[model samples]
Target: MEGNESLSSAMQERGLTQVELAEAVNTRLICAGHEGTVSDRTIRNWLTGKSQWPHPKQREALEAVFGCMAEELGFSPPARRQRPATEPESPVERRNFLTATTGTAASAVPFVGAPPQVGTSDVLRLRSGLDALMELDDTRGGHEGLERAALSGAAEALDKQKLGATQRIRLRLFSIAADYTATAAWSALDARQADRAQALLGRALYLARMAQDPVAEMRVWNSYAMLAHQRGALTEAIDSGLAAQATGITKRDPMFASLAHARTAIGHSNLGDRQAALRSLGHAREALGKVDRDQPRPSWMAFYGPAELTAMTAIVRDRIGDAAEAEAASHKALGAIPKQFRRNRALATTRLALAQLHQRDIDQACSTASNGFELMTGAPIPGRMRSLLGDFYRDLITLAPDAGAAREWGDRYRAEWSRA
Candidate 1:
């Protein structure tokens, strides 16, 4: 069957109406913490070929829901273009390098030659560029545009393989490069491109190892844990988290150790080991207490503060069905989270809503949920946040099927999805 036909057949097999399919897709997007939402009209257009190629995010949701690739669903992949030799030293060139180095192309290394002599100024420029990209990610979600530019720039710089640099300078460059690579990998994970994320993370891990920076190595391991946790690989997540903790301990970095322990707690929580989760959380708290507030932290770990830790605690508590404690922790998290981190605020609100629902406060839960939804406007939602909202939506419906507030909340959610 052709793409439309294949899609239709899949829908038919699942007995999903166009509206149902749209809802399913939106639910998935919400769970993932993505920004855009699909409407029934969009799905109808896709089916009727009125719209040919959905956005990559939309395509990802459709592929996930239908269990098929874009090609299998009758959507043609973009035509490949050959890269020109001796490309300009621009962001575009760098992004191309990143795209080329990842996925199936990973086995093939791009052309490398001794070109420019590396200097301190060059390293500083690269560092500033990465800092800008990271700032963009923190303020806005991981937009493909920014992520591509950052990834490409870092890859291009790394490809130069600066020779004759001092060992200290070389290690610094490698550490910075690895951090940038890890950030790109995180962006891939947020976009639901698991293969790309894995490839980037693998490269980052190598760079970290080469740099011999325990802090950088720990950061990579923590990122690996997050990726694995997001994909539901609990054992791998825990193992990575443990590895990070080991590095933190070896480095004697309290902040890194605290964050690593919290990550381990998440893994334990996901595995339904409440006792283990709580114990790990306590360890995190203890390590965090020992952290000197005056010391400078690595850029990657800079966001790991009391607010983040509190939010994590709420997540673990909620997982273990400690509704009251979860609600308290969620409130504290929300209060402590910085205004600039809109996504984290939204996620904490979601947890608060869930906690309220657990307490059978449907009205309060709906209000809190509505607030969370509002926070997501104009921001790219994470899959985890979307998933949390989806769960809240489902629970609201199940628990209060006949309540007017629940119905209103549902209508608000659907309207938001349609507009998304």
Candidate 2:
């Protein structure tokens, strides 16, 4: 049998390795009250066409994970299992039966004209698009297309929310809308358009409150903290980070709590509160230690693991003028960060370069900084990363105005900077 190119391409686009894909499918299985038994070997079998069709439960979980039909992922039913064309489902029967069952299988088809009866399946379908968007953001950081697509998703969710749904379904739709809006805000922030992000985040927060979704609320607060930090509003950043920590999701998920604490630590350090910052950093580490790695989480949070926390620690240490400690933390982050996260790797490289520069390792700093450009060779540098690089460039010239190495560094990256 030929390899499952469709499945391979899907995984590649999402930057998911076979092991990660297995883990994600298993997480969804566990969430649906099934044993999370999918393994990397099983994923390999699927990719190699050793398994043409997954078990029914696994299929459902895969559909949920990818937000598409099993067939779309290159799975094929055996001849004996294929439904006969002679017994085809009529349009009305298909519609009414699907509306009654509220199954996610119907999600492969888009709703046309009037919105059909909304249900759990509809929410899952919408979330699939969000999952794709999140993957794109991870690969490319931020761009205008991402922001526009997020807003369109939000609009679609809102449109469906008004078309007769159960109270629970209605709230879930609102939550989805909030999630989409928050994604838009995040994209804007990554693009360094702080004002646009602020407005979108405000709207997202309001929608999240309406839905009473603590997770969505926490996501918005996290973005708000980053936006505040970008604007030099350290107090506001701290407050927003604290708000994220206060969200109910943090109480249930230690990983999320750790992220909130880490964000708060950055604000505290930047505000010159070294004691408070270090305290928060300690809290972050403690909470991270208690996280349940096997537990299922939303796709948006795939980036916030130990690697990201270590990166945050580097930022905090840098802000507190602990150059050596910052450099060590940055090194740790780069060592642990996954290869698929090119933007993150580049960002960490820039941070490492900054630490080296602060330590007066002029030649070494220039070399380290150049690695960021290499990491993101084919991709456009994100605005936030470009800003960080700009910071490094200015500091380099200021510290070594007459150094040949500094002049060489500028000559090399000048074209790259202008292109970005």
Candidate 3:
């Protein structure tokens, strides 16, 4: 059956064994209020064509577990009775049509031939190129043109088969490819293309697994958390963040663990669990303290440091309504971040404005937001920045509906973001 082949292909791409797939499916089923768990034997039967089709509940569980549609998972729904010839298309049908077409186009990239025999020099060049792309993303917030170029470069590198390369060299290439893919996924998320981001992240996770690099895997999982959080899937965000922490703990990497914990804290805060949020924040701080200065850090993690931590702290504090502490943290974050990271500076400034608003400093908040909004006009702003600014705008309108400064700031934001 086509179902068996599709399932097998999905398992291979995700680096999952049949047993692992069974476990994952069962976990999803339990979460979906199903009564029983499937065994590895059952999964084997399904993948070997012994079982041609799953029951409706099982099919749903499988689709949910894999983040795919029924047809993508090789399931054909039962035939429907004939409908009116002029029936109107539903929103769901339109979304499905777009998803299928886009997914097909994205997967149709042509394979490149084998790469030339490479040495450390080639690896170094690739790393440098990736660093440049990352710097652009940090400054300009993921321009679509730049993202496409970066993705193409990384995809070409990954497509090349290097048979003569040493095991160490091959692993390094895999790690580099994974890093690029993860960065591309982040760019997609910044551009508000969630489906594309998820697809890229799945590939990144597979590449990381091939490299056997726990640090890279942790980073990819953290990216998944960020994407989920952006999409308002708080439970998924929490789960992904915890997974990142688990990987980081296995690798004994305090910096990675700290970032994961900080993300988890934000998830908890968003869920209104203040105590859990505070506990996670404390864990994040403790982990950050344990990062050794003598050890070399991963290049992908260069953007993370005290400034990023402070920004996260501000976000959690704001979520929990700790206006005073949030304002202080936001100021600290802004001071600690360098001027080169203009996007981060803008985001921090927005948070600072939000904190000021919470404290009833309407004039100061309007002034801070105006400056931040001006900075955002220099580039194609990230979705996260726009979302934060939206929150600030809503709060300002609610709190100071008649203020001229608030009205001016709102007008400016509308004009700037409309172009964005």
Best by lDDT: 2
Worst 10 residues of 2 by lDDT: 91-100
Cα lDDT tens digits, model 2, 49-167, are 99999998777766655556667799999999985566424312212111211333432345678656888987897887778768767877876556755776787789787777999
Q: How accurate is candidate 3 locally (lDDT)?
A: 0.75
lDDT of 3 at 319: 89
Q: What is the C-alpha RMSD, rounded to one decimal, of candidate 3?
A: 17.0
How do these models rank on TM-score, best leading? 2, 1, 3
Cα lDDT tens digits, model 1, 1-420, are: 233776787889878888768755653344344643788898888888767677866766565555445556766544563234464433122122222222111223455885446678767766655655555556555444444554665665675465557677788788777888888887777655677888989998999888787877887788899889778899999999999988834357688888999999999998999999999999999988898888876555656889999999998998888989999999999989988777678878999999999999999999999998788776556555666778898988888889999999988877766432
What is the C-alpha lDDT profile of model 3 across 240-275, one tens digit per residue?
989998894435778888899999999999898999
Q: What is the C-alpha lDDT of each candidate?
A: 0.74, 0.84, 0.75
Name the lDDT value of residue 14 in candidate 1: 76
Q: How many collisions per candidate? A: 15, 0, 0
Worst 10 contiguous positions by lDDT, candidate 3 = 91-100
Candidate 1 residue 116 C-alpha distance from true site, Å: 4.1
